[model samples]
Target: MTLLAESPVAVGPPAAPPADRMTRRHKLILTLLLGTQFMLTVDFSILNVALPALGADLGFAKENLQWVATAFALPAAGFTLLFGRFGDLLGRRRLFLTGMTLLAAASLLGGLAQSQEVIIAARVLQGLATAMATPAALSLLTTSFPEGPLRSRALGLNGALLSGGFTAGALFGGVLTDVLTWRWAFLLNLPIALLVLVLAPAVIRESRTPDKVRLDVPGAVTVTAGLLALTYGFTAAGTYGWGDPSALVPLLASAVLLTAFYLIERRAAAPLAPVRILNRPSVKWGNLGGFLAFGMETAVIFMMTLYLQDVLHYSALATGLAFAVPGVAAVVAGLGASRIIGRFGSQATLVGGLVVQAAANVGLLFLGTDRHWFIVVLAVLGIGFYGNVTAIVGFNVTATSGLPDEEQGLATGLTTLTQQIGFTLGIPLLSSIVAAGAAGYGSTTAPALALLGGIRLGVAVDIAVTVLGLVLIAVFLRRAARKNAV
Candidate 1:
């Protein structure tokens, strides 16, 4: 999508101060970019509802059905930085449009797939295109909005889009998959993306640094391979029995590539990810906190949706509607985060939000058949509100604000990668815990309850981690305060 920027730089020069920058019509541009994010988000989980349809239509074995999801997620997770950096050096608008074009081709091809392998290949290409587009969308956002109120507002909208996408996807998936055709679900993006590609030229301006620098091709490839290996290894455990050669090989390969990635980043003149930006106090802790938060959050949603359908015997629409509560609350909280942070300080707002969410997880831990689902859903929605929007996206804005223009893309990439990693890792991690817990019990209520227990255990771990992160924020603040006092 074309970002209608005056210059090619991610963040254009400080235009005539706050007064002039306030007039920036980023709202319209973002409306289109977020449409892209929504489609990707929908596609990821929309398949969960349509898995049976896909299996029947495409004749996918139990082992390969997941590839439809993994193929897309892995490529997107693996290449955020690879493509984000390309946008920085090359041109975000160009990279953005090219990604949409590629994804459009893949999506149309996917709609016409006659074999499982062909469909999987299309999904992989689609993921790559998403990787290129998603980060570019975010980086363009950073550039389009100036550093303070505007940027935070823009990012808040992004958070809303993200939270809303998950709920919408599930709801639409059932309708599109059942009523029309499963292929239409995949085909939905064709028109939306085409519209974005067309409108982007008029609404969004192009942005890139004027400096000519060689592309960091090696760094991109190595890191991409490394992340793919890691995610592939983790996500494969479900189908491969964790002991299968396919699983072990990818996991081991990921370990090796990850080790190599660090070494390559250390020496590269034009690194895909700059190690230095990671050195910032806020940037480091913020990223650590963000990763854990998104990872646990994604896993929880996945588990809960299944529990409602498989165990609690709720219909797909009811399950989807239940999730909409949280989506709405997240939208409300996102709009308020900037104001809250300004009033309460970033540490207070962020730590306070995490603490409350830990409490919510504690509440969710006790949920079972005897309990009221409405109450449980309400608590979960409330928990989601402050926990998500105020934490990851807000922290990112604060952390990345300190970096240089060149490093902005890298900063966005690192944070985006962390979220993607969390999403990728969360699936298998939570699944293994639940599946293992179920296996320990017989084919009865005991096993089903055990799955709930596994979710509880997972949430407990997340609460502990969230608490630890909050404590770290506390320590980080006190130390900075003391240093300043001296």
Candidate 2:
């Protein structure tokens, strides 16, 4: 049977749930799910601000400090698809609870670690926990709420809190490190995880694919290895330059492994990612839109970070404070995104959001060394954050709307993978552009000017990429509409 055979159409707010059914119980379930999501996202960036303190306390070599973050990110990105499929085969609630348990243990271990190896090991466990939990939690959320304003609202809150968590991590990491210790950053997860463990079984329902399907081990292995290689390659490129063998070798390996995965999926009796699902116009275009939206937004944030610290010379605290504006904007956008999608439909919201984001990048082209320009920078970032959040919600709605409950895990997995890959690759790609732009200016150019030139170049590229994505999404969605009509 074709699992995702429905004609791909633009998703609008579907029929609303009965007023009585939309009760406090539903709200509690949403809070639990969103809280889980928030904790995972917070772990991604919480260590960044604490890196210095962590490295000093652990006696980490300067060159090896990146590993702390990389350890968590690599497994989180690489194993997500596999674990997502597992959630379908096993039970989502079971996997989710297990992941939460592991996360709590890992956090405790990391907080109490005395050596570098132990801390890195703990981070790896945490990464594994994230990989297992994310898609499971997401699939649960999507399945729990019926397709309509309810799901849109849940997704909007999900996107908003995801952004908020990253921002909060950075903000709180610094404060926690200064006031108490870096260990508290990891220890914080313990309580959150414990709370989820206590309440989840009571609120979240268990779900899995009803059909008994055999696992596609080859497909799983190849795709997991491929993603790992791909993520590691980009990360290495960010640190060691694109030309370095450390980046080149893995990039090449990733290409080969991913190709093998495609071939395996075509032949596998029960493919991890079904070909029919992937071939759907909504799934294909929606994911591409998500990839572009997330990649460019992350690239912009990295560039802005450099601009704030290197050219504008803001202290770390000052820079974090400045970004709080965008964080708040994301929350506001999240609050309103469902209403907008309900009114405009997902297609219009997605396209409009991308356009607004692109326009905001254009505004950043004017950012310069003058201190007064910081205001413009903040304003545009706030606008961009709002657009990004809205687009993210639209992406989630569009990509997963037509799929059956049995396939929700795979659908959520693909959406989650796009996000992780976008975050993994965005910085390196734009950093390369920035570096090339600066290098073209030669040695005699003022250091700050060269960096500024590079930042502008990166922003321009962000604008171009967003525009291209908008065009592609519009064209494909239009084509899908015509095909459905015929």
Candidate 3:
């Protein structure tokens, strides 16, 4: 039964009343959960523009600053799924609040951090907090909202948040950094978290599974370690050289451990991997394309902000203004996506977005400027202005509805993990690629132009690869259509 079905079943032993009817109180709870998610996402995206300012305050070098971002991503990536499954087994509400506490503390510490190590450490703590809180937040939302129009409406708003955050982050980061201080970026969470924390217990109901399930500690550890090691490997490769033993060693171990994890999941009861989802070509291809798109998107904003501030010499606010296209585009896309999907089918929409994005990338390539200023390149950059998130968000809501309610916890967890891991790993990889290429240019115009050139090519490659992924979508969707016709 969808969470939105408004028939009153008696309230159960676990918590939260059975939904037979709607109440204003119920909507209030949903709002609190959504607020939690928005805060986490905003915190996640806000730091991109603020990174340069952060380095100035903390004295971290250009090369090492990736760690600041990596610190949050690595642990968050590692822990999300593992903790998510735990929430499935244990209790979502308990994990949710616990994570909130830890995340809040880390944010406080991060705001006060004086050195690179301290900031990095705080970031990892922040990651851990989000790791616990994020899945719980999703599971709560999915469980609370009754399926159908209400759920769809709620999910659409949530989808807006996934990209809406970028706009808020860019604008807010520049504002906070310019006026108050870069540390305020981290500190800003305090009030928002404080607001939600106060409201959660009162508004949100407690929830847990009725039956007992064994916790998969071994599976969780190995997978978490594997992801952490892999991320560490990719991140260190940029600095210590790709061939460095320190970098290569952990990555190899990550591979072995993950392989073992798959084997374990195959046999284990209540498997952590959820084998059925892995078998779908739609899910697999979607995840691959999503990763590439996310990585490229991060690079778009991260390096662009650098090009704007460090190279082009734009202020934080101007830099934020420069990105108005993506934020606005994303919001429009989110609102209209259902109708678009209805008209075109998922496959067509996916292809359309990629084609548009590819054009944006190519435009950026040809529109290069000798100066760092973004004014000239804004129109060009608009070409690569597409994302898989809106499509995927809808897919998730629809597909997972067919799934049993108990399974939705990890369903939400898995999608979140794919995007986070992609962002965590993609940023360093793309940035490093651009940096390496820039080094080859060796002249003033050559270096800046090289950076733009590399990104342009990166977007071109994204376009090609995305269109190729679209091929899979076309094949699969047609096959589905034929089967449905039969």
Q: Can you tell me which runs of candidate 2 are displaced by over 4 Å? A: 1-21, 56-64, 404-409, 431-454
Candidates' TM-scores?
0.89, 0.89, 0.87
Between prediction 1 and prediction 2, the one with superior lDDT is 2
Worst 10 residues of 1 by lDDT: 1-10
lDDT of 3 by residue, 228-264 (tens): 9988887787677567897889889999999988888
Query: Per-residue lDDT of 229-273 in model 1, one digit per residue for the tens?
Result: 877877776665578787789888888887777787778786656
Candidate 3 overall lDDT versus native: 0.66
Tell me how candidate 2 scores on lDDT. Answer: 0.80
Candidate 2: residue 206 lDDT (0-100)? 74
Candidate 1 Cα misplacement greater than 4 A, ranges: 1-14, 61-64, 241-245, 404-406, 442-450
Q: Is candidate 2 or candidate 3 better by lDDT?
A: 2
